[model samples]
Target: MTVSLHTRRRQSGVTLLGLLMWAIVLGFGALIVMKVVPTIIEYSTISKAVNKIAAEGLSTVPEIRAAFDRQKDIDYGITSITSRDLDITKENDKVVIRFAYNKEVELFSPVFLLIKYQGTSRTTTR
Candidate 1:
């Protein structure tokens, strides 16, 4: 009598197509993040400017705008929205300065991304 042995083989791995697909997805995500990072930095700068304006007791719209302009002049990153676009309001007699703007970034042909940013002072000076 003779004994016989049988061996089975299985294949498991990512194909070329799968690798390309993953690369595409990650590439798109990286592109979006690249565009978003600068926007986030600008927003942070704007927030700091707003907080500074409020802390300095700049209640009037003109005063706040001028303050922001000065800040923008000092820091070039705050260029998206100007003083004219600011929304100054009063809540319970406390001055509130708010601003909103949109940034358009093109990823590829006919593909664009819209980023909206808005912020207000943390606390009123008065």
Candidate 2:
């Protein structure tokens, strides 16, 4: 079968346009993923810390308070944390910890927006 060059060119343009559209959609998806991923990671980390204390037998607000040794950061949106001992807890009683941090992020991929991420962590003694 013989096809016209004009027809082929037109088809090419259409393919290009479709590809561009797909790129746009994917870009937005990537942007959103980036914005949300950090929150998930931060919260998970904090949660893990709480669980660690929980496994250690740190249960109760006072025990948590006593065990909580670091401020790390306040929950204002996108908080940074460095692990450290700010407080002290008993060796075998029940100990627990609770805290929150905020994450602030801006996105510009296939879309543009600013979002604030609020996350908290809690752990109890097993």
Candidate 3:
């Protein structure tokens, strides 16, 4: 009597190279998130400050800039732009505050990420 030969089933899973590649991708993603989140938070803080100052009825440009400086001093997150960087304007009897800045993040020794942030506050009565 002849015995039947059994066939081996192929394993389905990540190989060593695939696993390493995935690990590298995930690591880079984590690094970018860690670097970019703080900038986003700082931008939010700046936006809130601008909106609040615009609504506070500061008619003069100096007053608005000073208020922003005070707020920046209180909130340590605001560093990318200063009070002087603000572009204050009035439109339709409403105060508007605009700001723009650039943030450069270093990914490695030679690689960098440049982010440009710009925002304007809601028009409010001065």
Best by TM-score: 3
Off by over 4 Å in 3: 1-7
Clash count list over all predictions:
0, 17, 0
Model 1 agreement with the true structure over 41-125: per-residue lDDT tens digits: 9899998988888778776788888888998899999879898998888887777888899988887879888888888877664
* lDDT string, candidate 3, 1-126, tens digits: 655555555679999999999999999999999999999999999999999999899999999999999999999989899999999988999988999999999989799999999999999754
Give per-residue CA lDDT, model 2, range 1-126, as digits (tens).
899887785433457789999999999888789788877776665565555545655445555544333322343332454333223343444443334445556674445454443333343334
RMSD versus native structure for model 2: 7.5
Which residue pairs clash in candidate 3? Answer: none
Q: Candidate 1, TM-score vs. the true structure?
A: 0.87
**Cα misplacement distance, residue 86 of candidate 2 (Å):** 16
- Candidate 1 lDDT trough over 10 residues, lowest sum: 1-10
The best candidate by lDDT is: 3
Least accurate stretch of 10 residues (summed lDDT) in model 2?
A: 69-78
Ranking by TM-score: 3, 1, 2
Error of 1 at 64 (Å): 1.4
**lDDT for every model?**
0.85, 0.52, 0.94
Superior by TM-score: candidate 1 or candidate 2: 1
